[model samples]
Target: MPQPRSHDIRRGRYSEAGRSYLLTTVTHQRRSLFHDFHHARLVIQQLRRCELERSCRSLAWVVMPDHVHWLIELKALPLGEVMRRFKARSSLALHRAGVPSQRVWQAGYHDRALRREEDVLHVARYIVANPVRAGLVRSVREYSHWDAVWL
Candidate 1:
């Protein structure tokens, strides 16, 4: 089988401290059912554990049916450590829930660092609005599986 093409972001480059990122990850095979509101709640809980353990700051996040977008500020740990723990814990939770699969996430995730001049809050709003734009909800507030510190 052919290998998947890599995205533009450099992996493991942000292994140092003090980098903020907008990260995204999708379910394997684009399986929406794996990320329903209930499952997403569990995943969010796991993410919280990761944030607390790694001491990262979560600015915004939204969990869609098959994917998630997170805006976070790295504090004490490297960005890679945060993502690894988040993905690992969420996968374990899904497996415990009887997902009946070998994998829950794609091989890698996408991340982009925010420039100092950019509006971080605006970026967060865009992340939270994904459900509305996808027609899953009439308004972002109506979505049950998203949250942001600014909201």
Candidate 2:
């Protein structure tokens, strides 16, 4: 049997308002475009912009070299729409900032909706600790591109 395409895999996925989700998306070809501080900030700007627009409430986020992990509580929009807006806006921001990548993000993102019984704080910590786990910093505090509400 053949494997499902990315979109196909998400066909049955549903989004619920007021639910928290952990989202991950990669840069085109995993090019590490975010290694540049300014470029990374552009992406972060978009994340904040999305929140201000009330698409979702950002709980935690980390901008890695080639990817991003975001924990958010869905607001008015569905998960797919929220991610769509974020990726599109961030890609435009990267272009305006003079980044070379025409496609700032891959076609789709991965999302896991948090269950009520889950420890949200634990998940937030895991998201912010990505840089430490990746060896980019000796400690999470040493990394500058991550944020969490609990911190």
Candidate 3:
């Protein structure tokens, strides 16, 4: 299969600071690397670190077996940059932590920018309820790798 060009992958996409976005990205080849609890926790740490680094405020997130969904309010950086750094940092940390991977994530990610009037809490609920929707768990409380401020 031919790999997509980077420019084509990011075309028609624009990132602005201070906007809330829901981002989703998969692992390389959709590997179930996050099935391990510790590895998934590492990703959660990096998600919070992105907030600590002033890139974005993590509103909600979930770590599935092969992908992640992150809802964040951007601080002063482009969403693309924030994601780039977040992925890179997490990949590095995971490697250093003795987690084996040829690559930590796929190159492109999906982002949906929220309008001012949109219900953020609704989105947060959707994010945290992914496990239930995926049949991974019977209840949100049973999911070990998801979080939302409202929950």
Candidate 4:
């Protein structure tokens, strides 16, 4: 289970902190907005900001053309609040950066909680190799919008 679906989170389920989650959020209307380097950088900035805020610690991440996949460890907040902050702040930052004054990410994100016995390295590999899976690059090194703490 990936921390329940978006609807479940809204209904007050699986809001636990101090867990690892693989999160995915898409652009509004599935727009390829992040194909633009500036917009992508804005999202990266928000990710770092989230880490600095201590809501979550990013373990690995990949900013795709129309979506993002982030592996993180919740530190000081529930997943819902963390996601809310990320969405809100990123939208505001992007708007300030002249991307748009409207919503940037979709209403909800998908999150998968990792198990204690799970191999995190495998998950990190999956997250960082998304570009290759999407045919955006032939190798992980060619993708600039991805990072893995373990790598």
Candidate 5:
């Protein structure tokens, strides 16, 4: 097996408007930065901003200690642009919140475009269940950093 090249990340990628995608982006060096409530809320604010600006409709999202899992329906922009803006804005927000790290996120994100027949609710359940799966919380209800439209 061959290792994937960095440029291959975007190979054959297409961003169709109105399509749902699950995006995961990790913090730089996978540092558990979201452990602090304020730091985590800052990132959450950026997610809300993306929706408010009509970039994407957030179906579900969970701000884990070191990464974020967001299920969103692409709106007006391409997936790359939406992610670029989100990362930039979130980095700025973290800086403004007194987080000294200049680099908040890793270079790129992972996105899974959902097929029309896929069960969106099932996917959302899996997303919200991340905290429980990671053993950070006993139940989804106990996780403070996650949300889903169905829940």
Candidate 6:
């Protein structure tokens, strides 16, 4: 099979400070089973650890069966470093749980920095509402793998 096009995998950069960002990452090979609700809960726990250790502030998050969406306030660390530590820790946890050795996150993640005029709370609501929007649940409360500080 032909390799996917580079454009299909390219991610943009965010260089501004004090900007809230919405980020998303998918499991390797689009494997939905790799991150079930229980695993998603664990991922959230790990993220909380990263928050305490790296000083990140998570506004909202939703962990889908195959991917995750997070809205976070970049604190003391650079966004790149924050995401690196997050992925590394989560990958290690998943590996120890017997996830495939070849399974790993993609090289880059998707991030959209909010403009100064944008409403951070609105974006956070959107992040938490992903499961409903995707038709995975009738309501955000029905989803077992989502959380937010404001909610």
What CA root-mean-square deviation does each model show from the true structure? Answer: 2.1, 1.6, 1.4, 3.8, 1.9, 2.6
lDDT of 5 by residue, 39-146 (tens): 999899999999999989999999999999999999999999999998999899888888886689988889999999999999999999999999998988888998
lDDT at 69, model 5: 99
Score candidate 4 by TM-score against the native.
0.90
* Tens digits of lDDT, candidate 6, 64-132: 888888888888887777877888888888777777677567666788888889988888888888888
What would you estimate as the lDDT of candidate 2? 0.92
Provide backbone clash counts, one per model: 0, 0, 0, 0, 0, 0
Best by TM-score: 2
TM-score (C-alpha, index-matched) for candidate 2: 0.95
TM-score of each: 0.90, 0.95, 0.93, 0.90, 0.94, 0.86
Residue 83, candidate 1: how far off, in angstroms?
0.9
| Candidate 6 residue pairs that clash | none
Rank ordering of all candidates by TM-score, starting from the highest: 2, 5, 3, 4, 1, 6
lDDT of 2 by residue, 48-144 (tens): 9989999899999999999999999999998999999999989988888898757888888898999999999999999998999999999988989
Give the Cα-based TM-score of candidate 6 against the true structure: 0.86
Q: What is the lDDT of residue 77 in candidate 3?
A: 85
The RMSD (Cα, Å) of candidate 5 is 1.9
Selected candidate, larger TM-score, 1 vs 3: 3
In candidate 2, stretches whose alpha carbon ends up further than 4 angstroms from where it belongs are 1-4
